[model samples]
Target: MTATCLLPLFETSYVAGEGPDRFYAWPDALILPQKVRGFYVGFLTYTYHKGGFYLLEGWFSWFIVIWTVILLGLMSIGGYFMFRKFLKRLPKEDGMSILDWEEHYINETRHLWDEEQKQLLDELVSPVPELFRDVAKSKIAGKIGELALEEKASKITEDLIIKGYIVATPKRDHKFLIKKLNEKQIDYSRYQSLLAK
Candidate 1:
């Protein structure tokens, strides 16, 4: 565990028609070394005015800020470790296996079809222009169904490939796609071309 220093906080108030007035609180003036016995722990402090401690010691606002910062820092660290573990569990994409057309298709249309018998007929069809902006619009609408289908299926139908509806590639196996993704370092468009046999 690392130590963090928390400094004192100040409070001020101002009237709409008047000027600023500073309210000095005891807790706001105290600073903790943060590290105690090799571990960092935060504690509240009380201040004495002139002679003794009273009911009105310090502003509660400072206490809130100090604890909030500490809480967020711990949460961020936890989140980082959780993500690291998730990355470790996921399968690495290499040449032929890099293509996730089937998974992508399922995810995109999961809500529309039953899990047991999901099919491509549920997807809406639209023409996507070769231009980047047009293709992006088509993708957002989930209209590239034909292309997605061809990317994953082992056997491509002659009618679909001839109509420019699906992408075909020389590399048919999942390993080939994974290998291409890893060894060739090609972009997604390049993958589409490579698959478009």
Candidate 2:
């Protein structure tokens, strides 16, 4: 409601011998009386200063405000340490995150991919924007290189590049991947098994 419609309520805030007398006479509508009572308790309980200003000049108010800040700082520091400890406990291959291993694998197999595989990787990642295309190609190559190292294969193949492209793409972006696959006239049905993974 506009301020004019609410003028009646705002004009009724009268202090009696003990407390606000206006809140006691609100219409007994469903839950409205309780809401008005809550509003009165929230505003009237705080003693206001004169000059129509809302400056809270008191020691107790300052103490509570400072204490809340101190507690928030303590909680944030504690939570950070707790998260670090938790991350340290998860099992890792070579004691590194996935991104680090991807880089390592990419370097290890950098010499193994023939020119054909390199061209295929470039084509597969072309759908990505120019800004992120290099990063996307590196990640896809790393994934394909990782599988080669796992199987101890001597070189990368068309199948490995295609599978890695699909696997590296997030599920949310699979539609774009499918569109790219269709544009290239590659049969995506053959990769349904990898997509299911």
Candidate 3:
């Protein structure tokens, strides 16, 4: 996210009150997060009790104002530096720059590689079941499409459905089936024979 967006996430203010009549105020010095929009915005507010002016009649009144100012100044300075540091620490998001795109691409590629490896490993260790083989054979019959020798397509597809990849429908269309297959990143023809069954 941009510093502009992060600015408002750190916004804060203060209020003081004793009863139905209350007071609110904000710092005199405003600190803002950096932005490429060429503008900075900060907010403040002041509220006074309906009839509490007498509360400020003593020497403590000046002390309260001075203390508030000093506290706000320190907070402003601290906020500026802290936000600058936070921005530096933020992980980059997509679309802002080429580096972001490259990072995303690399991560996607690695994930795909890992998935393929897992699939291969699973295939090597487990034998295809007989029901799946029969289903695969039936599915390939009329279309003249030859099924892969893996012969476990039905079981695999069933497992995928169980895992939430595929959904059952009362009516099926070839195009919609293909679209769902694509969304799952499965090879289009991989299940063609199996599906016929």
Candidate closest to the true structure, highest TM-score = 2
Off by over 4 Å in 3: 1-55, 93-197
lDDT of 2 by residue, 1-197 (tens): 11111111233333322333222222321111115544631221122233121223357545655666698899999899678756645548768766677788999998888998788778767778997788688778888988888889888987788878878878766777778778878788988887877
Stretches of candidate 1 exceeding 4 Å from the true structure: 1-5, 8-62, 65-102, 105-197
lDDT ranking, high to low? 2, 1, 3
How well does candidate 1 match the true structure in TM-score terms?
A: 0.22
| Model 2 spans > 4 angstroms off | 1-93
Question: How many clashing residue pairs are found in candidate 2?
Answer: 0
Candidate 3: the clashing residue pairs are 139-197
Error of 2 at 59 (Å): 41
The lDDT for every candidate, in the order shown, is 0.38, 0.64, 0.36
Per-prediction TM-score to the true structure, in the order listed: 0.22, 0.50, 0.22
Q: Write the per-residue lDDT of candidate 3 for residues 1-197, one digit (tens) a residue.
A: 11111112123334465564444332332233334387533322222334222122235544555666798999999899677656644556632343343344333333222455335323322232563533222222211111111232322232332221112221243455555446657565655544554
Residue 77's C-alpha lDDT in candidate 3?
A: 90
What TM-score quantifies how close candidate 3 is to the native fold? 0.22
Evaluate residue 176 in candidate 1 and report its C-alpha lDDT on the 0 to 100 scale.
Answer: 41
Candidate 3's displacement at residue 20, Å, is: 24
Q: Tell me the tens digit of each residue's lDDT in model 1 across 13-122.
A: 22222222223334433333345588644443333444322222246635655677889999999899678646544665642222244345535643433432222211
